[model samples]
Target: MRKLIFMFFTVVLAVGVISAQDDLSGLTGKKAIKKANRAFNTFKLNQTNGGDDLKEARRVIDYVVKQDDTKEDPKTWVLMGDIYNGFSSFNQAQKVLNPDWENIEPNGGMVAFQAYKKALELEAGNKNALDGLSQIIGSISTAGLDAYEAGDYMGAFNSFRSILDIHDLLKENGAASPLDAEEEYDNQLYITGLAAMSAGQNATAKPFIQKLYDKQYDKPAVYDAMYKLTIDDDVDAAEDVLTKGREKYPDDLGLLFSEINHYLKLEKIEILEEKLKFAIEKEPENPSLYSTLGNVYDKLYQTNYKEGKTEEADKYFNLSKKYYEDAIKIKPDYTDAIYSVGALYYNKAAIVTEEMNALASDYSKEGTEKYNMKKAEVESLFSEALPYFKKVEKLDPNDRNTLIALKEIFARNNDFDTSNEFKMRLEKVESGETIEKSYFQ
Candidate 1:
């Protein structure tokens, strides 16, 4: 009799469990959405507690979103957004509590954004959807700034781009946008383009960058970036944009340098001197500008001297020497300027020696005296060149050119020991061995 009662009770208990499972499996779309929202609210309110409520919400919402009964309802999509939004906040809370915990959904904010946008599509004036999106913007902005600071540029670009997309949507629907102010919107466009360009997303970056150009954004970097983007396909167009940028921001060093480089690339050295002068005035402390300007004048002197314009050549040679000296004063260790100055005197010495040798044919006493005077002048110039080449060697021991210059100068000065020493050093360096010590000392 006891066995019969126990079996009957077990059968009743099993039937009761089956009924409860049937009720759970046959939940309506509306019931499932309500359950999701309830679970989402519980997770949202106690996010710091860390429980399975958020997981339950996600499961219910995922199932309901595909159901015909609730898929077309704006409330359903809004609930969908709320569920993911809860996930985002809950993840944040979990991270703060446990620093080493991995994020459950790193892109939960973006997921919420799409859900809210879909809600708006279902019902254009959905207040919940609009408010959710506005809130999502702040979350995305934080993510973007963090990514940008970390040098994750593509991630930064995506986060910023989504905010702009939301901004546009808000404006199209005649709703208030945080970026409604013209200046704020323009700045967002500029930054989005900057991030995209840095990520090497040229095709993705073009629209934002080009829009800034069209709108005449008042930043020099915009034009600098625009020039780079346009230069490959249309050089004339690139120059046109850069010229406009320079005109807009005349004192900007970056634009100034871009113009200087452009002229240098075209070999338009005639205009480059003026541009370089402008750059020097803007940045007088820069040694490279002085060196470049010195080179420009040096070239000019050589051209005029070759053409027999002695007065013009003298004028340019003085200017060249002045700028080279200015460069040395700014950076005493500037090897290029030191070498250039040495080369200047060495070249003049060569010219004078050529003139002196020409008098070998004239053997009269007066002619011999004249030859001696020219030879003395040549030696004086070579003496002037000697100290600068020595400094170059001390500064750059491996410089083959300076070694050759030192060898020639010492040989001309009749210092065979020093000249032969440099000759040996040069040969060692050429054979890929370092000279242990200088023989000149």
Candidate 2:
């Protein structure tokens, strides 16, 4: 009797399991949608109201979505989209609690977007799908913002990209999108490119950034960004953008600086000189142009000197000095030009000292005479730098680079106390502490 009772219980449990598994498959047409609607309603009421509601919704919708009668129904697609969207919500909520909820389903946003898009494609007047698409777009935009604020740049890029795709899909379906087509396209493309670049997706960023450039966005930073991306792979392409930017934004310092950087990277000193000269011709009174030219000549001097071309190096050094003096003559209070002149003297003196030290020791009589003569020249150069650096200190009292330069100059001259004072101020500046204002005075 006990064996017979156990056999009866086992048969009943097996029948129950089959019944539960075949429940949704057994229904068709309206009956299937009715069951799905109930499960969806349960899901909507409380997303975490056990996973059964969403699971049943998915089961019923999956079955109905493939059936002949319901396959083309807009309502069926909407239901499917809603169910998957619920899955996304559930996974996100669960992840907060467990932090290990591995998402194995299709991306909820994309699935929902495509499903609702199809529903709308079938019937533009499908209010449910339209509303769902709008909500999805909002959700995607919000997700992008949240990711960006959290510094998850790739996540932000993906979310923004989806928002763009959904809006495009809506437009393709003859439905009016909530966003302004032109303005939103430009804004979205810019942000998407920026986020992609920030996430180190250089290839992905190129098209979007190029789109902005093609539209003549008139933003200097955009040119800078595009050039930076193309510089390593296609330098000619980078130069083209820089040239266009210079033409459009004649006074934009960023583009000017980027052009300078490009030439410096290529080590095309002569081209750089010509470019700077042309720029100065365009804006003759712009002191910054001369100062920039001076810096380029300084670089050329170093390069030529390194290559054993002493005459070329001396020629470049004279040109650099001439440009700096021109800049100063045009604007006496031009702090940058003033600093460049000081830097030029200090750098030249450093080179001379290095060469002399390499040749002889100061202990020998002949070496002593040579050392004293070279030392006098070096001290004279520092003396020339002194007044400019002092002037710079007065012009921009809190400038850290100037403070460092002053410290080095004073130390080179063996004025230890003044050098130590500047050193203290420099350390305070570097550490973000306040230095005594009277010290600069």
Report the number of the highest-TM-score candidate.
Answer: 1
lDDT digits (tens) for residues 1-441 of candidate 1: 999999999999789545423333567788888877777877767765455678777878887888889999988888888777766666666767787777676787888899999999989979899888887887778778768998999999999999999998887777888898889888889889989998988778889989989988888999998987888789899999999999899888888898888887877778989999999998999998998888888888888988889999889888888999899999999999999988888887887788899997899999999899999999999998988888888777778888998899899889999899889889989999986554434
TM-score of 2: 0.55
Off by over 4 Å in 1: 1-36, 49-73, 83-104, 201-203, 334-441
For residues 1-441, write the lDDT of model 2, one tens digit per residue. Answer: 999999999999789546435656556767788878887887778766457777777778888888888889898899888887777677667777886666535367667887897798778768788777767776567567767888999999998888778777666666677665688678888888989999999999999898888778868878888997898898788899888888888788678778877887788877888778877877788898898899889998999988999999999998998899899999998989999998898888888888778646558788788887887888888888788888888877777878988999888878999999999989888889865463556
Model 1: colliding residue pairs: none
lDDT of each: 0.85, 0.81
CA-RMSD of model 2? 11.1
Going through the candidates in order, what is the number of backbone clashes in each?
A: 0, 0
